[model samples]
Target chain A: MANSSDKQNRLQRLWTWFWSPAAVLSVGFTLIAGFLAGILFWGGFHWSLEMTNTEEFCVSCHTMETNLGEYRETVHYNNHSGVRAICSDCHVPKEWQHKVQAKIVAVKDVYHEAIGSISTPEKYEERRLKMAAAVWKKMKASDSRECRNCHEFEYMDFTIQERRAAAEHQRAIDTGMTCIDCHQGIAHSLPTGYQEEYQKISEALGVPKLGEEMTFSEAKSDEIRTYLDQ
Target chain B: MLQILGMIGANMLSLPGILGLAFGMMTRKWGFAALGGALIGLLEALLFAKFDFSQIDAIEMVISILIGIIACLVGCAIRRKGVLI
Candidate 1:
């Protein structure tokens, strides 16, 4: 009983000191140690982050196997010059701050995987449009930052490019149109029904190319109605 | 586990607070439990919501923090009132 009492007292004393004002030095040392440990931890973590930027790591997730297969067919993956771009080159930012932000946003992808949101190719297809839209939106917002990392207008040898390609590039420069504006399918297959979706959006927003509404003649309208009914 | 915590923070309105309170009551350390809950809630919110102060809904965060504190106090009261469990 005496030994038990002594042990309890020692434990109580240690607890008191742990919570006491006198433990400021102890707290300071702990904080310093923790900070040092954090540096080591986050350093290793950042290294792992960069390693995951590889094509191999990116495709390790079966969710991306289809994308990887598609990517392999792209010029970015292989060409006469033999220079190649990996998954991170296009999908992740080059700069650290932006990369971290992208990764934070990407945590949702991890969460989706955890929740089995796209556990199969069919499931991925079901959400492909939404996913494509999200990537498009991000690229538009960033002015295709990732694409600019490699294909820059300043360095492009337009003279060597085909006339149409040169004209389009010049036009894009003149109009401030970014790479993703027209080049979304450069890496992956365009989601199914993309044209229909784009047309609906344009119609909803009253695209300027479309003139004022034209009314059909009663006979034409009746014919169209009959066609629709059929 | 961080993912789970993040999901919990994202999906539940008051579950984090309740969890903290329950932990506090069980451990008989309501204040520390509440603080821990607040930290977890805040971290989870930032991680899962992908929200910084510049992007977050301040009202929602305040509500989460308040929930933690209130639940902890309730837990403390329960402990003090002799329901030791």
Candidate 2:
């Protein structure tokens, strides 16, 4: 009981010191100054984060040329709605915790860039499968959280969707399948043997192989066009 | 593990509330406290909202502001009682 009382007294003293207004400068002035400094620091940090999230910053590296070209050809870059998903929108997590982790993990990309790991198109192609697998593995593990930031399953209007898409989406919901489970090459070109790589990644990540046999055949492509035409 | 860490990081956003409490304690003024809290809360909400007003958690924002106000009021009461440690 004496030890507990001593601990409480110590805490009380600490609290008193913390809130004391006995500094050389007026406590009010100090508090306001510190508060403004905090704002500036936070603003600068946020600005830096936003600056790095831009498409120009992402494609600044010549190694990203291939991805930029592929992404430009996708509907995400050029659609009737004129909506655009920049590199960060698809690659970065919107959640604060995940975003910080992603930013930290992304520092490795700079190291690779400095070393010219995939500086040329040929070198990029050689490592494309492995790189794609890594991203797929992350997406699988996170259940494609970044994708859901823009494409929420709960908000999807199945009535306006193509028959195949509607059917597949319903099936996915029923089976606990995620967006990345079937939409591997939506924004970028799939590397050769991506199917095998994806399979291995899913297995390694312990994600259920829900769409193991699913493939977008030519008939489904025709159906998609028909649905779009309507 | 990541989620837990993320939550702690997010809670750091409330650090600004201390400024409100300090202002009230030093000035013994409720108006200054309210203004400080409101401004801080607004800035924080806008920062996180990122132009998407729909994404703002109204309840969380309000609660943060309320907590700041309460802390400031408590600080003012303590200082008014001549408890300047």
| TM-score of every candidate | 0.55, 0.64
Candidate 2, residues A55-115, lDDT tens digits: the string is: 9999999889999999888888988899999999989988763575577668779989999
lDDT of 2 at B17: 54
lDDT of 1 by residue, A119-207 (tens): 89889889988888777766765668899998899999999986756766786676566676556567787787754543343345332
* Fraction of true A-B contacts recovered by candidate 1: 0.00
Which docking band does candidate 2 fall into? incorrect
Model 2 regions lying over 4 Å from their true place: A1-23, A209-230, B1-85
Worst lDDT 10-window in candidate 2 chain A: A212-221
Q: What shift in Å separates residue B43 of candidate 1 from its native position after superposition?
A: 24
**Candidate 1's TM-score on the B chain:** 0.57
Q: Give the TM-score of candidate 2.
A: 0.64
